[model samples]
Target: MAGAGPVVFAAAGVATLAAALLPRVLSRAPISMPMVFLAAGALTFTVVEPLPDPNPVTHSSIVLRLTELCVIISLMGAGLALNRPVGWRRWSTTWRLLGITMPLSMLAVALLGWTVLGFGAAGAVLLAAALAPTDPVLATEVQVAEPVEDPEDDSDDEARFALTSEAGLNDGLAFPFTYLAIALATTPGDWLPHWLAVDVVWRLAAGLLVGLGAGWLLRKLFFNAPSKTFRLAHHAEGFVALAATFLAYGVAELAHGYGFVAVFVCACTIRAGERTSGYHRVLHQYVEQVERLLTVLIIFLLGGAVATGLFAGVQWREVVVALLVLLVVRPFAGLIGLARGRTGPRERVVVSFFGVRGVGSVFYVAYALEAGHFLEAGAVWRVVGLAVVGSIVLHGITATPVMRFLDRKREVLTSP
Candidate 1:
């Protein structure tokens, strides 16, 4: 334990370098950056006894804030990279997933948690709500890679767009359910009306409205400022993305709104500012770097938590429920939602299956546990951890090869 600080600092430097370069290196590989870092963190934390524990329950505050930051930054990145304009018809896939798949998925998971795992009402609902969002942080492989400036190049294809947009939009949608879980846990009776009014209505509306106003103003300042010097986009200050992200989120939170919704909406509004501007790309790149760094650290700590027996309390029923979540509930729900929709059969399968879960799940659980008393806190953590790990490993191995195959099929179909 003597002088462990220097070694930790050195390891931090190496992790930072890997974070920058891993995406390109692993683009075509079956393994993903998350897999590598996750395994590395587990191995390192297990072997190095001097390092601090990474347990979520022991350090709930750190986990909550860190995961929240990662999710919101990722939302901003996803929104900015999307080339598709906002429209009801254009975003039908996202809407379908949000409207149909998410609720169904939540209902199914909550039922399983209650009946199979004996999680009780509040715990079951909390677990379901926590796992509802397809994590924007761990879904980089299936999301938009960069801002699409050219109309001819539709890098944000149907499958990618569906996943990306759903991931961007659903995190905010999941918050109301999380609040429902909190209300159920804390209140003995008469919470429904207030929950419907405040958590469901006011928070959601405030987030969207705040995001719209902030995005509009920021877009003006960035791209349409009267003076050349006032136009930050002309300078290509990548840090402005962070400024906008934090500003939108903070303002929304201050207004008693959902910050996750505000950040993503703000990003979308900024993207709609000047479709052809190269500044969108600059901002997206910076946001991606920041998101990547935060994701790496959080995933690494998660791996450490795994090594430290986060799953020691996991039972057979919990295992079964977690498996069903990834293999059955999400896929079936997504498929049903995507039925007779925009994508073809193959795209539908990919979109349906890639319900990747990561830090956002952890954030929700931490937030809920902090806000309300859950008797099954340990069980919730165990099951969520199991599901998240399963998602990382399963999706990590398949994302590259499957997406490559999808791309090849699209190429064949489009070839003249």
Candidate 2:
């Protein structure tokens, strides 16, 4: 297929079509669209010759942009899907996951990297930060569905809600530590003060403010603009999700802030603006389609990368660490975070165990590699690739059965 552009286009078109249909086709089964595409990619590259190498390092810029866009789009869909109002008591589970569980997971993974995988401080920290946040894109099966017609139908079951909300916000929240990893890698010494002043404080605050401001402005334009012609929501153009995503992200990044945080926050702010409007469904549907397309492309490339030796030189220690991050680190941290909080034992376990890692981890690694010197870059890629692949397979296989079981249990428990 060398120089056969139409063949390439046809293949991609087929993949996109499959992406649109596979979720429903595979629903309630112990399988996922990502699994299919990942396997397809591996198999295709394994059998096909003269295919372009999908090494992320060789295509860092493309990798960064692909993963970044996937994340931003997913964050928008996540924000639109959530029905819950932000509140201290109402979002207690979310607060617990963000405040307690995320840090704990990061520390544990970092420790494993340092102690077991023999990574240096910077490498360990980067891996910890990258893998800490549950991916919003790949976790969609466990997240809330589209915006309902009724306002009271807002929140999902606690398990879904907690996972959804945690995945939405944590991607941005993990940026601080990712920057710290960069700081340690790049600087000679004494970057803490700079990190505190800029990375920790200013970037986060700016992202929040910019997100709120952009979202509020968009709300006015969409819902309450004086001119009916300018009231975008009334028109019900779904592509506005892209406009909003780009606007919020661009504005925040221009101010030296975390665009990922701003994008997710802006989505939440938009959800709050018209909580009951059907317009949200329009916006969400559009964003979800785009997000799915991006996901297919990404996971396909990831699979191709693996088939072409992305995981070469991967050692037993690194594989063990990857398993630990999935099995021990996240589950334990999640349980500890949700301790004495809302969810029951089963819900807690489901929420904790379904922290599926995917595109976001790749984003963080690429971003870090761009920002600083990571001596063990190959090791980082291997471990991260294994961890992500493991997550897609392990979580993808079980998410359906686990969720189905929980849904039934919830019904039995909640029946009047």
- Candidate 1 lDDT, tens digit per residue, 124-172? 8899998899999998898778897775565578999999999998999
* Model 2 worst lDDT run, 10 consecutive residues: 146-155
Model 1, which residues run further than 4 Å from truth?
Answer: 151-155
lDDT of 2 by residue, 1-416 (tens): 56768778989989988997899999978999999999999998998887999999888889999999999999999998888888999899999999999999999999988999888999999999999999999998888987776767744899999988899899999999999999989894999999999998999999999999999999889999999899999899999999999999999999999998899899989999867788999999999999999999999999999999898888999899899999999999999999999999999999999988989999999999998999878888888899899999999999999999999999898899
Off by over 4 Å in 2: none
Clashes of each: 0, 0
lDDT, candidates in the order shown? 0.93, 0.92
Q: Against the correct fold, how does model 2 do in TM-score? A: 0.98
Residue range with the least summed lDDT across 10 consecutive positions in model 1: 148-157
